[model samples]
Target chain A: MAIQQFEHGKMTLEQFEILLDTLGTNFDSWPKMKQAEARNLAQTLDGKRLFRGAQKLEMLMMALQSTPQSTSQSVPESSSESPLVNSAVTPCDTQKEAFLEKLADIPRRYQQNSAHLTVCNRMTLFVTQALAVNSDGSRLFSPQRLASQAAAFAAVLAVGILVGITPEETPTGSGEIDLSETWFVASSDFELGE
Target chain B: MPNRDKADDTILVARVCAGDSDAFRLLVIRHGARFRMLAMRFTFDQALAEDVVQEAFISLWLKAGKFDGAKASFTTWFHRIVINKCLDYKRKRQFSALPDGYDRADPAVGPEVKLAADGASNRLKTVLSALSERQKTAVILSYYSGLSNQEAAEVMQMNIKAYESLLVRSRAKMRKMLMAEKDDLFAAFA
Candidate 1:
């Protein structure tokens, strides 16, 4: 019908091309009414050239879209053949099985993965188990325990403070130096290089 | 026939949700090659296509519980997932260079024919790669993947009219770009 509209000059060439784009080069693929119109249009002088050009473009586009195997298959054959038609055929059995096998292994692998703990999960489980096994769960936070921990923390802090305030004794013998003496070199004594 | 396929897919997905690996495997066997071809059409590299399909299947497994039969058929939903994976792959590798001889010539082909085919394919790919991402997707989904416009629009999450517009613009752009090549193609036929 769009081609009919085009024949009547009611549709533009661009609009007619959209019908070609959608319905494709094969007249059989177009609507029954439109197929007659399209075929009639093709019989016209200009329409003949347009349809031929469109079919050629379709073939070229198919050549661009086809799998590597199909491209080679069409080369020695007629150019009028559409590579799209050839590539649309299902893949061979061996190739199909290879792709299927790759997918078939996924669920089993996923099952195995979820069944086995990850490293982080294992670490968490180990920590929980160790805590449950070694400690009386209810008494882990008793007042006496908290008091003991606090006292230990205070003693450690005190020791750290004492260490910080206490000066180190100077090394004796050849490494000994007088703390009161100053060893200084003036900047003026050095030469400034260009 | 599609309704029967959809019903079977629904049952398989339900079984998958219930922890049936066999059902999952069956679903994989049924749809794997088709989806692989779809991914290959998008990615153009077999290895990358396999990776895309694998990742999509893995997502399907984890998200099977999320599929609502009321919303979309299993194939349409899965097509969305596969297309998204391809789009994401394209985005991540956007800055990387395409490998040498990406459209490799057949060794069995004559040198002259090989050279011509290779040259034409390379030029076509150059023109194709220059298309905007959505235009490329529209062309691939409509022309290459064999999806009906409705199904492709659903996968693309676009209205039918919008999808058709995209297809029209895509064909127009490709036609303009290949005007010179069109002459050669016609001459060959003549």
Candidate 2:
């Protein structure tokens, strides 16, 4: 069969428009199999694939950005033995506060990792939760909280990596301890000592 | 709610993968309408279509980490997800027969018709229904979905030449159907 191929690629604007009209008008009688196949094709060709590298970069950036800043800086430097000593801070409250503080640092770390990772405006809630937990002064920062914080941060970092965004290297001599990683070491050491 | 068009899908997927609830919301808004349309075609019911779209978006949030640009376009991959969900819906409907009915009440005749003001679109839909499944799919992908023949072939899992043949046959059938309809309408009017 001598099938006429419409030069869709090279057609002038007017020609394209005409072709569009013709195709549009005739689309209804297309075979059922063809319609299903075309729908499938249309689904595939509409947009560019979401790149893994870009996605990873984005995730990492968000995680870092959502982390809370260090409480040692955010809290007032009082001469009191413990800021919560007079305030009747519960262990749970202290833990929450510590978690929040760690969470706040995430964004700054993300910035250090990559300038392209912008703070998502709505992510403040998660950051605030991280901060709020630190300030509560009830529970001391628990291993679980730290783990969650680490997981969140890791998830974001993974996204950054996926999206081909080179995360800024961890700042040298930032003096901030990675509590999540340190906790495992401390626990293992304590077990060995016992 | 995040601003539409401000954050791209790649960024949103990244955020969601990073555990950002807000980023997921933006994705829902960005692709919801398109997903809904795809679902509607597959399920033939508005409510089921909505469910399919929502489920597809949720899955997107969970699996955003798996997205790789080199494998396929985001839209295409997402469509595959939506289609799979719709297929699942079809299976469920077959067993339970969902309450919603797909009464043969003209699927494509809607607000767009008011804008066109011509009988062209209605005629098109009628002709589309007349086509065999594969040919109909080929025609729709080429004409409406805006896929290249090669991409359409890939989606259909067919050889390029076979896809070409399908398109040719589909277009010829559509041309014949439309001409016949026009003749019948003119005869009736006369």
Candidate 3:
């Protein structure tokens, strides 16, 4: 009883099935020793059915890869409109080049395409999130966002002046009206009444 | 004979690891055709397949120093590299007229391979695209690329059992889909 159960190894039917998912219908690809076990399993009624099913599928896959030359050449039987083209192209002949002519430019093309993509994305941002126009025709930028961004920017400039500008400019007596502080007032005035 | 070739590859891979450009070129030329054909399974377009092969070798050349002879053979390592590159290209771009993109001679290529990549692989690819990513990869590496189950496992970075499990499921799915396609075709004939 134990031998009967253990014939398939510790690999349960479920596990065996999971194994089948990756290996396809071929037992040859199985480990050299296990190939015998796999073939044995394939001989069972269910296994045979599965094998037939997979064979039909495999045949379809093969049909997709290389249609039988006879079938393609059958003319009346074959649906292909141009037998001329079919005869002209053989798999090995076409595969000879291996398509390496465009090799050197791949990186360059990727670089250019990626740059183009980035620019397109940046432009897309302006169209969607950045430039999202509201019901009215005015710019989509909300006052709150503008105000928040302005505040953050002003804080950065303030830190820069006290830490960088003041140290250099203060030591030289070139205070220069502290334009960092006054520019906001001028900008606010410029936006007034509009 | 295969063993000797394998040994030769080991030498070539080592030379490449040592920064020998000529060795790297030889490796490219040696594996280029196979890589291109493998890539063609992923991208039915010959031009795109070549692009995938080109990127694979370029990546291999850049990463030659990382090749660990003890862990995997050169062929397995390089196959993984090429498979990943093909997947990357597929992810980035949408492939149209696949498995059959070679219906006409691409002006870019000379007359040799122009006619077809196995007579319009698109029918299979369209159906194959329905599979999960791992299933698709398994079928391509195992069925299309002709990597043995064990080699395919290495390429997928999965254990033998796990890879087999995946292949089984993939084959089952393929059977179901292909059967459906056949029935559809028959019905059309009717």
* Best model number under lDDT: 1
Better of 1 and 2 by lDDT: 1
Query: What does candidate 1's lDDT look like per residue over A56-135, in tens digits?
Result: 66876665555343321211122233222443443433444566677877876765334333454444334323323222
Docking quality class, candidate 3: incorrect
Model 2 DockQ, alpha carbons vs. true complex: 0.04
Better of 2 and 3 by DockQ: 3
DockQ of each: 0.13, 0.04, 0.10
Q: Across residues B11-126, which tens digit of lDDT does each residue of candidate 2 receive?
A: 45566556665555445544554455445444445567666776666566555656654465556667667766766776676524432432323333343332232233334445
Report the C-alpha lDDT of model 3 over B1-190, residue by residue, as the tens digit: 5655565566565554444455555565455666776777677666777767777776655555566665877889888888788778888988654344445444544543233323235456766788988888888887666569888999899998788777767776777666554444422112
Model 3 alpha-carbon drift over 4 Å, by segment: A1-52, A64-95, A98-194, B97-101, B105-120, B184-190
Superposed by TM-score, candidate 2 places the C-alpha of residue A75 at a distance from the truth, in angstroms, of 43
Model 2 docking tier (incorrect/acceptable/medium/high): incorrect
Judging by lDDT, tell me the better candidate of 2 and 3.
Answer: 3
Task: State residue B12's C-alpha deviation in candidate 2, in Å.
Answer: 3.0
TM-score winner between 1 and 3, please give it: 1
On TM-score, the candidate that comes out on top is 1
TM agreement with the true structure for every prediction: 0.60, 0.39, 0.53
Q: Categorize the docking of model 1.
A: incorrect
Q: Each model's fnat? A: 0.24, 0.00, 0.19
